[model samples]
Target chain A: MADFNASDLTCLRGERLVFGGLSFAAKSGDAIMLRGRNGAGKSSLLRVMAGLLAPRSGALCWNGENIADDRAAHQSRLQYLGHQDAIKPVLSVRDNLRLWGQLRGVSQLDAVIDAALHALDIHHLARITGRYLSSGQKRRTALARILIGQSDLWLLDEPTVGLDRESCAELSQLIADFRATGGIVIYSTHIDLDVKNPNILDLDDFAIPMVEWLTEHADLNDDTNDSANMQHSVSPQEAVQ
Target chain B: MSGFMAVLQRDLRLALRQGADSVMVVAFFIVTTTLFPFGVGPEANILARIASGVIWVSALLAAMLSLERIFQADFEDGTLELLALSPVSMEMLVLGKVLAHWLTTGLPLIIAAPLMAVMLNMDQSGFVTLMIAMLLGTPALSLIGAIGAALILGARRGGVLVSLLVLPLYIPILIFGAGAVEAAQLGMSATEHLQIMGAILLLTLAATPFATAHAVRLAIE
Candidate 1:
């Protein structure tokens, strides 16, 4: 019965309104493929969803209640992987997963770490410290942290940045298995990924029209205060344009 | 398994694995304090006269040495972002990391300060006072330094900027700390200075986590 939804969300990065009038919803077992060119706000939108960035105005809800009402509770239910794979350089791959597993309060932790390493096919590299990892191995280590059932929702900024084809296939299988267990995944990438019947969201369709937004805001308040109303009169439905 | 302990354990393990971070801090403490006696001439009177100041200043800088590492690696590799997404409040996570930094860096400086004092020809009467003041003061260094460390998380030349921002804030601890030992050396009651340093430690303990956590959250954004 769990659902993830965003309503009337607008994001501003510094003075630029990255995206405005954007809304999306997905339920358990859903996969959302967030597609866009660089700077199209795919990353910004994911960060906003994760509560890492405060959207200019929006409501993120879970099960019909505002997620902002209980930010910690909302965050505890999900995991996020950004472009930079969060591997600690000194800890071995196994220890990195163990640290996260313990933080998430996962019981049977040894088994979980073992299974996660196996899923990503990085089990043999578990004993080596992260500093020695190749680019693909580092990405695999980052992926293993998510495979351990620590959180049911995943917000991946670019999960496939350094993954090889075999590794990509393994990751896609992991995601599919997660969905089979009622997990929700929202991933952003420029390359095609092997996802099952994904709900596609191209961020270009939802960007703030910079020239129009500037003229409209300049008319309202000439200096410094124009950022507050940049999303005025834009409808989420109009984002389809 | 608790988030605080998990972070603390990881940081300490990393510190041990890296192995050289704590050694480098202690080495800096020893080397910097050693330079003073030679520069001021081995006259016990002059060395003793400046002993407290030299030790405090060196320890202060030594604490700054490892502050950059507090968030730098995690920030660079994006572990900090995952940490942000955890159920643990950023403030608690900051506290754990600060405690780990204290154990690795501040604790060693405390162990080394008294030895440096002896080498600098400090008065025997002031030795215990120096240890007490440092024990109280170093935690404040780690705590206050964490705020500076986090504020400069993504800035260019973060190491330099952390020292610039943190060194000024360290003045109060340095004053009260060095003042305590100097008072003891002069046969005066050092209790007031020691009490003030204790107060500063308490204040930083209560306040810096929130400030550091706010900075950490901003860096993540």
Candidate 2:
């Protein structure tokens, strides 16, 4: 059984604080849904969990050990699906999925690949090159990539976008099956999904309010105690000017 | 190692499927080298004198032309993000991409350089040295160019920016690579120049993977 936790995570994107004092934890067989309006740090949080973006402050722990201490072990157990489908226009759907699996050092590749494609209902479109696939098909292809590897955690950012209702249902079923197998999932999306007993984290709650952000900006503008503030936040635009 | 091979195979497959990318690079190398003869007038001695320099420069530019493709497509398609998250280290992934790049872009340029050398009336003695030098030098071009490609990711005018960023770093390779052929033509041993080019290649090979991987992580961030 694996335990994943993020505590006091503060993330800065460019100069803006995407989120602060944000924390979440998930154990085996848990599904966490990240919900908030647009620009509410949902994707940033996902990226932070995936260890792609280093949070300015805080730590992510897997099985009570900080992930930063062993990035390779952390990476081995997680799969992250971002906004892009990662489909190469020149490769067929099947080849595209296999490339990811192979890169992850997945074994029994043929069986895993076929099963994933079938599960995603893209088996018929497997031979189709990425350039010819519709957005829905592309998203399905990307989803299928998550199934071929032995990942204990899945971090999906807007995994439901461009998916049809049927495809969404398929994804929900996949999530259910993954949970049943004791895998953990954390995902962000705008649409209603049929994930069972998801622990919802509204990013709006963790977002620094506009008033506080404005005051911080004002404080910076006033050059009051520059050293303390400069270490925490230096927006690229500010540095340029 | 399997991950590295997978990336290499996938990239080669993509290059083969696209069909036109390597061809365009080779054609650009050929056309650019051919123009030198026309511009300088077809005097054999003069053409011979400048042949090594022209071929090395053209090869450098051709390699740079394809540098953006090394990571641009992967970055845009989000493959890079997933790759960074995968079990394979980012450094291994960068190396895999650099190898595939050399195979598709560098190998072809090596094969084509001989034809251009002949056209430019290069001294017969310089031909083998030209091939050897490019074999040593082009991988460095691809390696150094990888850093540039990764740096310019998500930037505007990345193609132009990659050349500007990598071309200055390319000067040392150009000096050693062209110097090798010129030395061979002048009846001096080209080994010292070739050895230095090899050192550059090895240093770039060891260093660029980490640098390019770091740049790529930043680009993703």
Candidate 3:
């Protein structure tokens, strides 16, 4: 069983501190529901987990090995679904799915792709180009990608934004199946998800306070924004335990 | 290797399906090159003298026209983030993209340059040198331009921004490429100029993928 952990994660975006003092851990078959309002750093935390964004101060590890040390291995083991639906306008749905499978070095894609397409209920739209797909269809296509390749972890950012009710139900079913197969899913969504016994991570609890953000920005002008000073600025009492 | 090929093949297929993007780039090269004679007058001696510079400059601009789309389309639609997350190193995926760009934009420019050379009253002796020079030079344009393309991934008016960012860097290729034909026309060996262009191509080939990949990573962040 794989173990994923994040400790003392602090994220800075531009001149603003998005989040500070965040930590979480997951094991095989674990489902994590990241809860936060818009702009509460849900997406940033997800990106950090996917290794797409480096935290200002934190370490992400899988099975006790630092993910940063072996990025390719980390990347190979996870699938990330960002806010944008990555479908190419000119390519048909099947070709798009096949293209990603090929990218993952999945040589025998015919059966896997067909199964993924079926899982998302997009088998009928396989021949249609992405330009003609509705937002719901496009979201389904993007979600279907998570199943095309073998991955132990999934980092989905606002995955259900454009999905319809039926498609959302299909996604929940897919997530349940994925967890049953020893996969760990960490997803952020506003809608209720049906996954069992999910570890709920409330990002609001980790959000860097506005007053602290202002002080940090104020430090930028003083040229004293070094990590030493920044750490001191966060009162020991407020830091996450 | 399969990851690289996957990106390359997918990009090539997209280029083929769109079909017009490549055609428009070639057409822009042709149309832009054809205007030189009308602007400078059809004097054979002058046209012949200016053909190398004119063709190279037009090719540079034509190549620039297509640069923004190299990474911008993927960046916008979010394919770049996924590509970055894939097991393949960003450098390899970037190289695949640069090759696809060269095949679609640079290759067509090379093929169409000879026709423009003939129309500009270029010396017959310089024709082969011009084709050879472009063959050695255009890939470098795509390579260097990929850096600019990747840089301008989220910028406003990125097409214009790419030209401004990439044109200065393209000057070396422009000089050597045009100079090769000029040297050949003067009955001198164009090998030295060709070699310099080849070196520049190899340098960009080795370096730009990494640079572009880094820029792509920053844009994704």
lDDT on C-alpha atoms for all candidate structures: 0.89, 0.91, 0.90
What RMSD value applies to candidate 2? 4.6
How good is the docking of model 3, by CAPRI class? Answer: high
What are the TM-scores, per candidate, against the unseen true structure?
Answer: 0.93, 0.94, 0.94
lDDT tens digits, residues A131-208, model 1?
999999999898888876557789988899998888888878988988998999999976778999999998888887
Looking at candidate 1, what is the lDDT of residue B16?
Answer: 96
TM-score of chain B of each: 0.98, 0.99, 0.98
DockQ of 3: 0.91
Please list the residue runs of candidate 1 whose C-alpha ends up more than 4 Å from where it truly belongs after superposition.
Answer: A218-241
Worst 10 residues of 3 chain B by lDDT: B154-163
DockQ top scorer: 3
User: For every candidate, what is the interface RMSD in angstroms?
Assistant: 0.9, 0.9, 0.7
lDDT of 2 by residue, A187-221 (tens): 99888999999999999899996446655655445
Query: Which 10 successive residues of model 3 chain A have the least lDDT summed?
Result: A218-227
Q: For candidate 2 chain A, which ten residues in a row score worst on lDDT?
A: A228-237
